[model samples]
Target chain A: MRLLLVEDELEMAAALGAALGRYDMILDHAPTLDHAMAALANHVHDGIILDRQLPDGDGLSLIPRVRALKSGIPVIVLTARGAVDERVRGLDMGADDYLAKPFAVEELLARIRALMRRSPDIAPITARIGNLVFDFDGRQASVNGRILDLPRRELLVLEALARRQGRTVQRSTLEESVYGYDDEIQSNSLDAHVSRLRRKLSETGAGVEIHSIRGVGYLLRPSL
Target chain B: MRLLLVEDELEMAAALGAALGRYDMILDHAPTLDHAMAALANHVHDGIILDRQLPDGDGLSLIPRVRALKSGIPVIVLTARGAVDERVRGLDMGADDYLAKPFAVEELLARIRALMRRSPDIAPITARIGNLVFDFDGRQASVNGRILDLPRRELLVLEALARRQGRTVQRSTLEESVYGYDDEIQSNSLDAHVSRLRRKLSETGAGVEIHSIRGVGYLLRPSL
Candidate 1:
């Protein structure tokens, strides 16, 4: 998952970015409303963590623009403004959720997940293909009840492919899922990840295979 | 599309970044081999543009690591090393294409597109759904043989939905296709774009409808 964090504090942004990265969530940091606007113009995000106070203007003011650009995007206002009116005002301004300063990272993570669960495009929490079972919520994959420990990138690639099991997942689609703008890519990066993933799945008796569709993408299906 | 550019010169990186942005290709700049490696570890890219000289070491040396990370990712070495032996060495080092420094930006763009065409994950150049015809290569859509003008974002969303016409495209998948890591997303942005696209298509009499699958995503299918 990718998120836009509009926080002015560099430390906070860094902390959040690192914390979110553990869950394989990529973050695009916008230290100001202007920066945030530029980002919004260029990219689409699953959620936004907005700070009420920013260098250019109040983050709350940006909410309307955000709404104009993306009608139902979840925006959680994170700010030092903790009073009842402030919280209520933030909500009234269209912030879906609000949290005060010095919030627990765990709480933020839970809130993000909660927002995702309520998202209109939420996928099935769990999916099965052949003997392979995937827990989308937990970001875990297993074969016949044996958990398959895979690297973060490999897991992302697997998640994307497994979601569309029988269907071909385009290479571009996989690349978007596995890499963020911060990462550098070569044409073969996705191929390399898939090759590595295929070998691992086979060795683990996944009962599934990732098949390449030349000049197309890849299909994950029962290995019969 | 996303690419990694390994160049030590700030001016060169900035110039390339701006030039590539025009084509909607995101460029992740790495000033050194170490930075490039970090990026490689984190992201999967469609291609790489490597400069032979860098602060940390020769960019050619990074080719082996790139191969290890993503076996067949197309790599184009752009450098001042225009000697016959240097060009030959770059290709030997697994650079798919080599260009000397001071080459035309248009030429670089051409090479990138050419490499994409030959990539295993290349999608069809065009597709048809109902009366709507899409030229994936030219990035244009039409109905009744008349081009349907669309904003870049709308076109991207349309391309993704049209590519999987009659099928449910996960919101995450669509998000990946429309937004890059640099964009800030609110949960509703995709909906807004889809909604706008729907309105435009209806107004244009495209004879196709984008259906929301509720908790899944959107599907593009022929209108009744």
Candidate 2:
């Protein structure tokens, strides 16, 4: 996932950036509220990590602007202050989740996945084509109640296609959802993922196929 | 909104119950985790306010059960412990929002409203028919950019019908949404609210009509 980290603390930001890289997430750091808003204006990040305390202004102040855009981008507020009122205020202003300082990076990763699952336009609840079921929340696919143990990237590729089932999901859109913004896309990496996903689905009697629309994108359809 | 308040504190529960009543929200108080679970098993609540330090177990633990039901019932964790880790843990466990103790009742109300807006099946985003727009998030209706200042119950009645748009929303469902669970139905109260709403829409040139389905419910459709 591509995320913008609006944190003033250089050390925390750098540490988090490296940690999230292991999970294939790219982080763009914004040192101040102004920079955060500017970054948001230029590019769309899948999610945002906002520090309540920023150099220019309070992070809670950014929630209104983010919500005004109505893109439903999930925002996780980070604060050293773990006061109950502060958490309530952040959520009321539109932060999807909240994390206090001194948190484990694993927790952050888990929260991000949870937020992505609830995102309407991003991850659909589940998609069914014929007998195959792609459950976005579980990050798994199953055929007739039998699970398919596909790798992480493969599952992501399926999720992108499943969300747009019966229609083509552009190659660029699939890559954006599967890989972080700054990740160097190995020429055939997407094809590799889709190929493996297709094989796994067939092996499980999924009754579905991933059809490539030459030079365009990929579509998920029921097999004859 | 119909809510379940799972807090052991009788005084706080009573205060919040009364406050929410003023806004036409019904509160079902469950003083313990067991009671909360039992209440949930028997009846449905639009949302829940959970106290983390429950008598039997941690409030966060209940989130799994709530989510397991796949009802999409929003859970807001309330706690006196202001520790940062606790807040993150609550959210990671699936609490929709978190509130520390000593919070303003108004903040809780705002968070509840926010959660209701995100709930797809419960409260839809915005329903648009011709020039009329029912903005659920703002809890307001506008026509040609001009806002119609609708009363609380009137707005709720409009929201219930607008969500189903072309189809009729049953009278029972509309009553459940507009009035509290125990609020006495004054025979034609719903009709009164709908009448006012319909007239307001016409007065504002909102090209739509609320059609009463005889003895059934109400449907909103574009006016000829």
lDDT of 2: 0.78
Task: Give per-residue CA lDDT, model 1, range A1-224, as digits (tens).
Answer: 67899988899889988998898887888998999999888765778999987889899999999999987688999866448888898999999999888899899989987776455343444455666777665677877667789988889899888766555666776776677655658778778888899998999887898877554567787787
Q: Cα RMSDs of all predictions?
A: 24.1, 16.0
Candidate 1 similarity to native, TM-score = 0.48
Candidate 2 chain B TM? 0.80
For candidate 2, write residues A31-140 as lDDT tens digits. Answer: 99899888989887999999888778899898778877744688888866447567555555556667667887876787777667554334356788978877665455
Per-residue CA lDDT of candidate 2, range B1-224, in tens? Answer: 57889898899989998998777567888889899888788665789999987789888888999888756899999966568888898889888889888999999999998777455444434455656766555556667556778777887787767766655566777887776554558798888888888888888888898876555467777776
iRMS (Å) per candidate: 20.1, 15.7
Q: lDDT of all the models against the reference?
A: 0.80, 0.78
DockQ for all candidate structures vs. native = 0.01, 0.02
lDDT of 2 at A170: 89
Model 1 per-residue lDDT tens digits across residues B157-216? 999988888999999899989998677687798899999999999998998999988899
